[model samples]
Target: GAIVWVHASQPVQLGSGEALEQRYDRRPGGPRIHSFQVDGGPNRLIEALDKLPGVIAVPRLGTVEEDLAALVRRLTSGDPAPAVVRVRQGAGGAERSSEDRTAPHLARLWALQQTQELRAKRQVRDAVELAGRFQLVTPVSGAVVLENQQQYDAAGLTPVDPQTVPSIPEPGTWALLLLGGAMLWFGRRRRPR
Candidate 1:
């Protein structure tokens, strides 16, 4: 519904884990903080998180850092918290062989799980609303009603007349027309010149 702000980290080579403490805002306005010792690849993690509702383009900090920083700073001065990604590089960081291999996979799985959870939650919400309350037209729902002119005028809507409404001829009507045409042709052929 609104512009999405994404903050990402510089490219860090894999195998650098167990020595770094990555701390950042889960979301600018989010309630909790995230601290991780493993490098889940900030760019990759952000990419995975992009499936969430209202998320837009995933910005690459290394390439568009200055431009994005300027635009964001000018547009929003922390009015609504942007997604802040905090990644701290530590000394002797490239050590944990196992974490390095698993972090990316874990991060991707986390993103997919979050996406599915959100979708499921949305479906539940829609089902509850549709089942319990009066229905209204929405992007995700629709209805049809054949209203009279008076009813259409009351609702401030235009009603289509039955004559203008599209419909197919009945099978009997088609058969009768075909037989009439064939009889006419036969009569014309049999007539004397």
Candidate 2:
């Protein structure tokens, strides 16, 4: 028996009632899509879906705006489209209520890094980070928040890798003095004729 490794999304499931669900496993950079049939208990599907990048349950299709719907469709479809999409928090010029506040700066920075840097570099870690950040900002639920936090921890994305020097040692530029000293000592070198 050989161990096979694969980068795949949770299986797509056609569940009973409103539970019927599909997973869109986005390729890092290319326009590739994979879907699998989700089996087992609802808990399994729920858990799997929770880990997907930008996996919003879309509780109400009727309420979702047209642009957002299209965006979702494009993201989930198997077309020659960008695998990762930079989703603005209030995209489609949708208005946000006072209750729905924006995420913290660190969260926003993480999102930017995930989508712009890591995603551009085609790193799977980016997706994991993106998903975790999305879950945090979105009103997902206590259970999902806990589950995503676990995922982030597993991926080494949690705690945000502390800095060796938490605060700036000095305000002035160390480089300026060092370089100036070097220039004064060495002076100008004569070019060979």
TM of each candidate vs. truth: 0.21, 0.22
Clashes of each: 0, 2
Error of 2 at 62 (Å): 4.9
Model 2 lDDT per residue over 1-193, tens place: 1111122334454453222222233333333223222222233344544534433332323433553454457555734434445444555677545465554554555564455444335464655557464443321222222246678787665444334213444546677778898887666554334
Candidate with best lDDT: 1
Per-residue lDDT for 111-147 in model 1, tens only?
3444334343556455434422222333233455845
Residue 74 deviation, candidate 1, in Å? 3.9
Top-scoring candidate (TM-score): 2
Q: Estimate the lDDT of model 1.
A: 0.45
Local lDDT at 145 for model 1: 81
Indicate the worst ten consecutive residues by lDDT in candidate 2. Answer: 1-10
* Native-referenced Cα lDDT, model 2: 0.42
The count of backbone overlaps in candidate 1 is 0
Off by over 4 Å in 2: 1-44, 54-56, 61-121, 124-193
